[model samples]
Target: MDVWDLNLRHLLAVARIVEFGTVSAAATAVNLSQPAVTQALSRLEGQIGMPLFDRRHDGMVPTVAALLLAPRIDAAMARMSSPYVTMSRLRALLALADVGSYAGASHVTGLSVPSIHRAVADLGTAMRRKLVERRGRAVALTEAGVQVVNAFRLAKVELETGLSEVAALNGQETRSIAVGAMPLSRARILPRAVTHFIRRYPMVKLGIAEGARPELVEPLRHGALDMMIGALRDPLLEEDLVQIPLFDDVPAVIARAGHPLAGTAPDRRELARYGWVVPPRGTPLRESFERHFAEVGIEMPKVPIESGSVMTLREILIDSDFLTLLSPDQVSVELEAGWLIQLGALPPELGRTIGLTCRASWRPTEVQRAFIEELAEASAGLPGALHPDLSPLLG
Candidate 1:
């Protein structure tokens, strides 16, 4: 069931009932009459298609479903950070904020344009802040609006996860994990992990979003993505995210198969002579490339084309003299097909620490945790992995 179908206040009442173990106490906490709380509990239980509490002479005894949902409701409510916000207002603004236009939001939500407008206005008035503003032909969130949307996004994730957890307990697989994949992960490890995961849990849905680190990080922070897999950053600056190093990806100096340096071991200077096409400066691969040259007393090659696309790099390397540094894992298929070949390998020091990144506060459900374990197993099987297995943290 869509979480939006449930009432925010009813969910809160159920959570309070779980906490206080009695309808009367829950009603007192939420400022509702005891009868109102009891009625709301009944309505919520009916909507959920399960009993949330067993009415008893001693006190309300929470069912298994209620125990599963209570903490999720508590976390979601905490993230929302406002008691006055209703489900209607949150849904309306999120649709508008994500779509950027009334027409787009209406198309997505199936709500009338007027209704979307009214809901957004209502949310702004309730918060006492302008949440949205016009930007040429579309709408944009003001700073206040962005903050509200982020909190709501996280709260939505929490609520959905809670519902899905309860469903899983009932033998229904209704949850999905969204993973942001950098280019390197897309090549071998991620596909392998996904295939194995699907074999084990065929009913669970998985969405893989391919993008550069810069493109993926914000979505991960906002709960749009469950995790990201790629090169690790040293001294990762973000306090809200944690990185797990699964393997060291050796940097390969790659070029077309028939190039002059194809079968030869070239020094950094020799490789630097040809123009380069590498990822933009900030990425781990790009940084490794910079280090390989400058650290050894050679000038860094000029990168005429900068991109995070393997397809673009492959095509450029195939037909031109442009060389690039990449993980062999990223171009294993091309290497096998002889469309591209590695001319030389960078020093081991220049290799990247590749692994997983996820929000520090994320609490994975059963399937989600299994996917992470699968990733560790896949990384261990990759060629030249430092460790035979990398799931000690999970264990």
Candidate 2:
């Protein structure tokens, strides 16, 4: 069954039944008659395509599915008890979590201190758990609160997507996409795709957040990012994420223009003589670099700086003779502008399959899916876009 068919009341009834272990007790908790609570539980089971509870002589026995879905439903129900739970209440919780204080939330939301306090308290009461803890002068979200906050953020995005979809159906123009851009994408693929996307959907807003894999992965999982573009992991790291291949990104040894190593293929020992700039430790790029060096019978060169910032590395490369390893597409602009030169090419095994990364369960709206199509079209035109060997390797 789909999420849209899910009724909050039915979910709550199921949860309460599991909690109190009887329809009569659950009915009292939600202030409904036992028959009504039983009907709600039935509806919930029908919607989910499974029975959440077994009616035993003693009470209701929760299934494994009920156990798994209970916490999330409980968290959602905590802030959604009354029909009067308004957008303001949701905003208050988000703001409080963001700014870390009721006063700060009040300042950001332009709501009164009392209103913020009431909203936050009501949310906590609804969840039957304390969302925030105050240690005299400090405030922090409890673990349960953090889960609710993430779910609320996901709900907000879903609401926006619903509005955008309805607007599109009615011929109104409004859309937005949040993209997590990695190093390789910032250079060529992502920029080109964004340029094309805007031209195609001018009314659509594009938000880009740049970072390494570790920094971006959590956001994607939490639904804060629509999609991420960059080098795909070899083993496809997270079970909850899906990676779509677009093109092959091969690495190169790069140096400043007119550097002594610019036009020559230096031996491994000669390559080891110079100080280098490399990606931070524990990244795919760093691991690949190390593996490549090990295969060539040379130790990793001395690194003056470890960085993933293209601009920062470019500035350093332009003034010093330091060699840096990078995806060719990442330095396309500098190479074309004569600010950087490709000293040598890396082996094919050093290649990474660059593409899109998103939560495995993500269901993109029409316009959002259109942008993915645009990204694919953009990648098709890049040099060495096809890598037949990559399929087997990634597989």
Candidate 3:
């Protein structure tokens, strides 16, 4: 199921054969001989353990496997951008781009340092452009190099997706989705969706990468994650990303069960008197925390610690007078265990919107779409909706 195992040029030949209808023409289009193209097709069919074309007296007739794989190959080739992008050169550049030195690239790829160095050099010469530039002791990609890297990454995504799709057709069930889980999403929505999703798709694996937005966003953009789920930033800064709002999460003032504010519903002024533990300043929760006081026309409280870790926030709040603004879903276990209590709820207007964030250009496979549907169903009633006044408004 590894895209690297399959020849990239041969994959292109498969698409060309699908397009041109004969090995002779596909060979001409790819600038290879007819025998080579025929051999490539035979190799592909052998590797996939399925015929790509029906040999006929008149011409090559595309099979279901060819039809299924051709578009994915075409999409991948389109992203590859240049005909000079061989698998070896592509791997070398990506490895060097990732680790920043020929020695590091060699270590990552297990290729000899000279091999990686020569491959990258050949790639630059083939493209007639500078890809990497030395800066003092370090090296970095040029703007053109960054663009090429992005294209290669996306092309890899397309090829991998095609490989998974073909594997599924053969009943191999290699399809998988890599997801970036923001804190709130992992706390509730992601778990619920994943449980429902796997019941219907037991063979498809889900790799969940949990992190805050800043940590996960780059991977999401680089085609490393199929999607990210959590708070949707207002006026979302990334033009390449598309957000689908699942619901609004109205945060609450959370304190220990027997804290001074536990017995009573405190006003903003009273809540602001004690020290607070909140997410970093720029995050949605912290902005809402600031608004929690601003809404009541009170000065902000002193923040002794800034973190997004539920465990850290829970421990500090339990042991001290510090309070934090959080969705009830984020600390449901502690609340049920009598370790924490929702001291007061922020007005629904000041709440954060939770949802899915995915690359704008992504075309998800069937299983990925099904997972999204499961997410939507789970969002129909969220833990944040447990608050009396705010109901989940599903998108």
Candidate 4:
């Protein structure tokens, strides 16, 4: 039995059963009779080749498979229940979101103004909330409308991914992965893993977007990115995001090979004497760098240039004595090629946890999970790969 054979209502019944823990209660939730719910559960179990629940005198207990499947089912059903409930309505909403007016949506979607207007109105009515407001000749979504549009957008991605997963099972490839690459990830981890992933899954398309954490977080959250691989936040800053620790990003103070600071561990004041190329303010690296100095009661060095680019920092350091803090992994090639010198590692307390970050609600497809496995393999021997002291924190 194929999951494709299960309708939305059937999946909803499964989720409801899991949530309510009894056939009668689940039937109440999904507006089906108890007998109908029981039958649907039976059919769903048969189709999936697994018993989602174990019947006992007290209640039905969900299996591990049911627990894992519940999130995807709930997410997809949420999309189906969004204000733009059908494809036509969703398309109209999306068009309006893009163009900001019913007439513009009509022009873009090749839908009549009345059709677009009715779709938007119906969406608002379905959601029991006003989505758009007219201001002069333009239409603008209210806060609630923006949220609904974002949900619809995610739903579109989810649907496409579902199709791609189905195609993969049939020995067909119709998938793409978008990765948000932070500085350390772009330098080694992501590139290496992507090369390996492509060699193995040649049919799957891949996109790599490089940016700072602040730049990538929104896209990662919005479903524009499959996942982000880079420095993990200490205490895991974003509640809506989940971080999987891969390693520790222990930064090093670096300078040119022949610089006066080479082979010498300078004190904080002496270190502050040199001009620096540091990460932009508010970054984890920058915060760590500042904390190191603050702990020693010394002001941060004069920033001759601020950048997140490893290459830029390396070139600057190579040409002059501009000290900067970076993960040694980020400048491994340059350091090996005799272009840069690592002055010293940051104090043991000053490292960032490097890892994978994704939306907390995200459910990886088989291919995406495979890619993550590839990433883990590629990052195996990376420097500072999750020190023992930090293992407990990660665990």
Output the number of the TM-score-best candidate: 1
Supply every candidate's count of residue pairs whose N, Cα or C atoms clash at under 3 angstroms.
0, 2, 0, 0
Better of 1 and 4 by lDDT: 1
- Off by more than 4 A, model 4: 1-74, 80-84, 134-138, 257-260, 387-395
lDDT of 2: 0.76
lDDT of each: 0.87, 0.76, 0.85, 0.79
Per-candidate TM equals 0.93, 0.74, 0.91, 0.76
CA deviation > 4 Å runs, candidate 3? 107-110, 135-139, 383-395
lDDT of 1 by residue, 1-395 (tens): 79898888889999999999998889888889998888888887777778988989999999899998999999999988877778888888999988899999989888899999999998788789899999999999999999999989999999999999888777777989999998888886899999999999999999999999999999999999999998889979999898888888778888998998877888877888999998887788888888888887877788889987989989999999889888776788899999999887888888888888988878777788899988888888776565534243354
By lDDT: ranked, best first = 1, 3, 4, 2
Give the clash total for candidate 1. 0
* lDDT, candidate 1, at 384: 56
Model 3 has a clash total of: 0
Better of 1 and 2 by TM-score: 1
Task: Give the per-residue lDDT digits (tens) of candidate 2, residues 226-275.
Answer: 99988788787578788888888678888999998766889777888899
Tens-place lDDT digits, model 4, residues 1-395: 32334555666778887898888898888778989888988886665556789999999899765775666667776765642375577788889988998888989878999999998899789889898998888899999999888877776666566546545554667778899989888877788888899898899988888888888988887789989888877777678888777777678898899999777778888889989889888778888888988897777678868998888888888899889999777888889999898888888788887788887777777668778887877777876665223222222
Order candidates by TM-score, high to low.
1, 3, 4, 2
Deviating ranges (above 4 Å) for candidate 2:
1-88, 383-395
